[model samples]
Target: MRITKTLWNKASAARLLLYKRDASPPSNAVRVLGAMLGLQFDFEEPDLLQMEHRTPEYRKINPMATIPVLKDGDFTLAESHAINLYLLSKYGGEQKEVLYPSDLKTRAVIDQCLFFDAGMLFRRLLEVSQPAFIGKIDSASSTHIRNIEEGYGIVETYLESSPYVAGDRLTLADISLGCTVAGLEGINIQ
Candidate 1:
């Protein structure tokens, strides 16, 4: 099923299709960022547990079979980080531009932080989660807990100098990292 929204400016507005998971932190980040930018998008939720994302129809949209896929008109893209960057670049106005600065240095820092979240923080969480999802483990092991703690320590150090992850101002890095960190709630890592 698909739900479309007609924005205020139809001529300039592009139809956005977002494949998301309701409980997914990455998906939540995309939804929050879109709302902040005042961009309307259609949403489709595919059940990963039920293997819905593995179906032919879903695979056609994203060969990687990942949630948080974004389709703008005919252009399809997977990965939440890439989607957030594209959305901001395409729809962000002057006021919204601060979220992802045009300055080369600032943009680089934001990109670095975003990569850290993807490669380090979120990766650690997934290591713990994927095993539990398939009944490989009843709970996180000592090593998994240590890894999560180490990731948190890195985040804490990064936050020491600024309120947000990248810097003082809110950026795509913050949205991405914030959502990834929020996923730690349900896990018994404590």
Candidate 2:
């Protein structure tokens, strides 16, 4: 019974770690990471080293000096999607079977959504939200709104077949859309 209890506890812990509320990345990346790990999160202000990206000190930790940098012990990694996948793999395990998908065929579909999320969805969202978030509503553009709508329309079409991009599963694709669409609503971009 003790061994059984210990195993159960470890499994639960791993499951929890799979999706913790992280604040380092923009809400977009956090949402993707949460979706990939099958976790929900609330956005918060992150506690980071106070320095500019181009600073000499920061470059030692991240030569690229990007905003969303992940330092896991000695292994520091970059790239938003790559970091999301790494976090899922490190913490989610078999529970992430649906999100990450072990099957090559299923994985391909998830990959397509991930790519779209990183490319078009993010692009549209960033362009639309930048002006508003920075307190410059006048900077918002109809072109940005159109771009965002196009991506959202694609997601709507994809949703018609499956509940999510990976078909009947609330995969990382859902998380990406959820985050992106939510941000759009926040900025009142329609």
1-190, model 1: which lDDT tens digit per residue? Answer: 4433326313356678899977788888898888887677788888888889999988898888888999888899998998998887777766346998888988899989989988898889888887887788889999999999999999999899899888889899989888888887668754
Q: Compare the candidates by lDDT and give the number of the best one.
A: 1
Clashes of 2: 0
Clashing pairs in 1: none
Q: Can you write out model 2's per-residue Cα lDDT over 1-190, one digit (the tens) per residue? A: 3454224322343322221224222345645664545553322222333335557875775686654555554566655677667667765666578577888988888889878887788778767555555566755577877787788799898888887767887776666666666666665644
lDDT (Cα atoms) of all candidates against the true structure:
0.83, 0.61
Q: Which stretches of model 2 miss by more than 4 angstroms? A: 1-54, 63-65, 135-139
Give the clash total for candidate 1: 0
